[model samples]
Target chain A: MKSDIILAGVGGQGILSIATALGEAALADNLLIKQAETHGMSQRGGAVYSHMRISDRPISSDLIPGGAADLILSVEPMESLRYLPYLSETGYLVTNITPFVNIPNYPDIEKVMEEIRKLPRFIAIDADAIAKEVGSSRASNMVMLGAASPFIDIEFSKIEAGIRTIFGRKGEEVVNLNLEALRRGRQFAEENR
Target chain B: MQKHLFLGVEAIGQGAIDGGMSGVYSYPGTPSTEITEFIQENPLAEERNIHRTWTANEKTALETALGMSYAGKRAMSCMKHVGLNVAADVFVNAAMTGVNGGLIVTVADDPSMHSSQNEQDSRFYGKFAMVPVLEPSSQQEAYDMARDGFALSEQTKVPVMLRITTRLAHSRAGVARKEVLPENQLSLPADPRQFILLPAIARRKYKGLLESQNLFLKLSEESIYNRYEEGAEKSLGIIACGIAYNYLMEHYPNGTCPYPVVKISQYPLPENYINRLDQECDEILVLEEGAPMVEEMLKGFFAKGTPIKGRLDGTLPRDGELNPDLIAKALGKQMFSGYAIPEVVANRPPALCMGCGHQDAYVAMNEVLADYSKGRVFSDIGCYTLGALPPYETIFSCVDMGASITMAKGAADAGLIPAVAMIGDSTFAHSGITGLLDAVNEKSSITVVISDNESISMTGGQDSSAFGKIESICIGLGVDPAHIHTIVPLKKNHEEMVRLFREEFAYNGVSVIIPRRECIQRASSRKRNKK
Candidate 1:
């Protein structure tokens, strides 16, 4: 009945889409949700994060305190490790293996993956490849969200419905493609975990 | 009633609309831009034809809102914390002028400087102006306070400030709507010379403002936003202000703090509740978002009161924001922390977009400036400020809005010949004009680079007031027309841009080189909108 998630990625990487989908699903279930987002200057391709908390009871803080996050769901591999301090000891870290190499001094991809592999419970997914397999590479964020879905408290069907509601305006083809991307990602996580 | 999910800014917008706001004025800044944007896009606001448009700057925005209030229509003006500094003259005087109709001044403060230069608290401004300030602890309260803030303003015949920090402003939560109230009919102030600040009349108005302190305090004491709750423990009394209350409650998830708590969202310190807490507890802890205003006041100049502790006393860090862990640590509660970040994780600072016009402009400027000694370029607030960072590093200063031109002028006056001022089009419109006029009159030896991206480009591409009129404005301000050159900022035009920059930098008198291009982000979004 409670979930504290950290959505992390480089700005413009579409992590907010995952937040929107989760927020819609949480609200549909009549759960109290608080999501704190990064806006303004940081949106210009900087490290960005959104702290999302959903509970059956009234939520107190917009922020998920350090080490209280149930899941660190990141769309980028290196960006996932950036929020390790917020992840609970037994929490899940579901992150995309693709690196967003905007900075000149980005660490080696293998080193970043090594850090992620050190986590007690984590799913290192090739979300981009999965989304491409489902039809659109742009749906990578959806894939990452799906990979994290197993750890979230919400039901899978509700998440699908949430996606339908959010992407309803974008037409059925786009919605169905994203759903497939989500399903493929979930399948990968289920098999890998 | 079904709850509508809303960001804190959106809640305020909806609240203002439902509370029958006739007009909403603002200049875009982070954490505060969405309030006006929400009103701009709302169906009801459109149907009612309420005033919602970007102003040139915060000062003009507040003044326009004040004009609407002068006509007895509920009005709101919103801005980020620094914007208040630009509008402070009118803000303070408005307290003296009072209001004919309800006026709410909503200010969003960025505590961690997420998108700001400083973290100065706006509560001090409210206290200085001696007006009521409502700092909501939640999105629900954000809605309710903005809805009822106008009433508070009207009751006291002064402006009410609805203040929020960046966290509350950007955070999303469910907010239920209230029944929509009708906008007030237009009417004039009862006193004919009320707004006229001619010394004799101003003195009397100032006296009335001073006398209203008691009424303001009484209202604060009676405010629904300010409350005192009894607890089992009295060893330490805690005063949680605004969003800090939420962080405090986060520690006690069951909603029970052992210490007696005074939750303050309404201003003037809510003295009565504090006095009660002071009498009962051995020591007091003050929790606030920004500056330790309450803590300092309680401790006083002599620092001999109730063993008060906060930022000043190091119960909390002196700078940055207050998070739940910080609060828990202060309370001596068990803390939770996970693994440290790997050493290989490098910093990824915000950068100009890959195909951004500012990038091309900076490339040209940096190439031209390579010949000259470093530390000559003065920049203003905008996305171009990122030029101060790696890859380009063309700009030397990223001071306040429009400080580029004036600072360049000062440096030139101090004999740093050919001083360069790099400013954005929107910022040039904001406050650069006055400084440009001064430079023109003095014929200062400075090269002004008006990087015209044709939008604010920062704070998410709000329309720039100088969109198509930059050249005309510069010319009208008495800059020599021939010396003002325009070049398209693109890969193809790099040589021309470099030539223009070199030409202007060598000019003995004031010269302006405009690198014109639409922000790629704005251009793409426009394309999407068209599609």
Candidate 2:
């Protein structure tokens, strides 16, 4: 009945969309939710994170303390590793394999994936490729959300409904594309994990 | 009752609206910008014709809000902690003048300097001004306090400060809306000379302000926001202030901390609860979000009192935001840290966006300045301040808003010929105009580069007050028309921009080079909206 999720990614990568969808699902289920987001200067291509906590009980802190996150759901490969310390011993580290190589010192992609692979409970998926395969390349965050959905306590249908509700204003076409991306990502995690 | 998810800032905005606020004024800054933004977008505000718009800066915003309050309408002026510094003159004086209608000065402090230059606690400002300061521990409190803050202000006839740190300001939670109140009708203060703070009047007002401290304290003592929770354990008394209470409660999921807790959201320190805790417990641990104001007060100058532990005593680190883990550690709980980040994960500092005009502006400025000494470019706050980062580390200084021009003028005056002042359009509108005037009045030898991105660009592309008028403002400011050059900031115009920079740098007087373009983020969002 509780999930402490760390949504990690570079600024402008739409990690907040994932949080919004999850928050929608949590609310629809009549659960208490708290989300702390990074704003201002950090949003200018900086490493940004949102600490999202959902529980049946009243959530106290907006932040998920280090080593308490149920899921570290990240849109980028190295970005996922940035929040490794926040992951609980039993938590899942779900991240896209796509490396957002904005910085010059971005470590080797293979090496970064090697570290992710070292985790006992982790799912590394090519969310970008799957998102592109589904419809829009912009829906990679949704795909990552899908990959991490299994670890989240919320029902899958609620997450889908959440996406639909969030993207409803964008019209059905955009909604379906994102839903498809989500499904494809879930499928990838199911088979791989 | 229906519940809606709201960021702390959004909750305040909604609460203000529901509390019959007639106007909300602010200059956009991180964590605080969204408060004004929420009001600006609210349908009720639009229908009610509430005054919601970006001001030139925080000072103007507070002054205008004060003016609105003079007309006996509920008004709110919000700004980040640093913005309070700009508005301090009016803020401190407003206490002496008091208010006709309820006035709430909401200040969001940035602890850990998330997007700020300093981690100044605004609660100190509240204490300095001798006003009722409300710091909400939860979004619900934020909503309730903001909704009722006006009433408290009116009852006491002093501006109430609702202070929040970045965590609470940016965090989100479900907030139920309260019954909407009607705005106060237009009426003047009964005392015609109440606001006139002449020396003769000021002395009486100052005494009244001092005398009213007891009422403020009584209100704090009786405040619904402040609560005393008894615990069996008296070894440690914890004074958790504002959002720090949340971190303390996070440790005890069942909402039962062994130590007696004095949850203080309303300040004047609420001495009654603290006195009980002080007398009851063996030692006190002052848990607060920003600086150890409460902690210092408890310990006194000599630290001879109760064993007070906090940032001052090194029980908590001196700086940075507090987390549950830090609180747990202070409580003698086993720390929980998973794996350390792999050394390969690189630090990704914030940088100018891919198509940011600041990049081209900095590029041309760097190219031109490569010929001169490196430490010549003085910059102001905005997206252009990112130029101090890698690739084009052209800016030597990034101080407060509008310090660039004046600093450059000072450097130029000191014989650093052709000193460069790099600033942004929004900042140029904020305080840069005054500095430019100062430079002009002296005809100081400085090349001022106004990177006009047509928007604030920082804090999420808020509309700049100087939009479409940077050129005209410069011309009006008495900068020679021939000396002011505007160029498109693009690779194609790189040569031209460099040429203009070179020309202005050699002018030996106040000259301006404006690189005009729309912020790419704003441009892209505009296109998206168009679509």
> Which candidate wins on lDDT?
1
lDDT of 2 by residue, B1-531 (tens): 779899999999999999999999999998799999999999999999999989999999999999999999999999999999999999999999999999999999999999999999999999999999999999999999999999999999999999998999999999999999999999999999999999999999999999999999999999999999999999999999999999999989998998999999998988999999989999999899999899877887776677899998789999998999889889989966978999989999998889888888888887888888779999999888888888988989998999999999999999999899999888989999999999999999999999898988898889999888887998999999999998899999999988988888989788998888889999999999899
* lDDT (tens digit, per residue) of candidate 1 on B1-531: 899889999999999999999999999988899999999999999999999989999999999999999999999999999999999999999999999889999999999899999999999999999999999999999999888888889999999999999999999999999999899999999999989999999999999999999998998898899999998899999999999999999988899999999999998878899999999999999999999999888997876668998899888999898899999989998877978999989998899998988899888888988999989999999999999988888888987989999999999999898899999999999999999999999999999999898888888878998888989998999999999998888999999888888888988999999988899999999999999
TM-score of chain B of each: 0.99, 0.99
lDDT at A81 for candidate 1? 91
lDDT of each: 0.93, 0.92
For model 2, what is the alpha-carbon lDDT of residue A138? 91
Give the TM-score comparing model 2 with the true structure, all chains together. 0.99
- TM-score of predicted chain B, candidate 1: 0.99
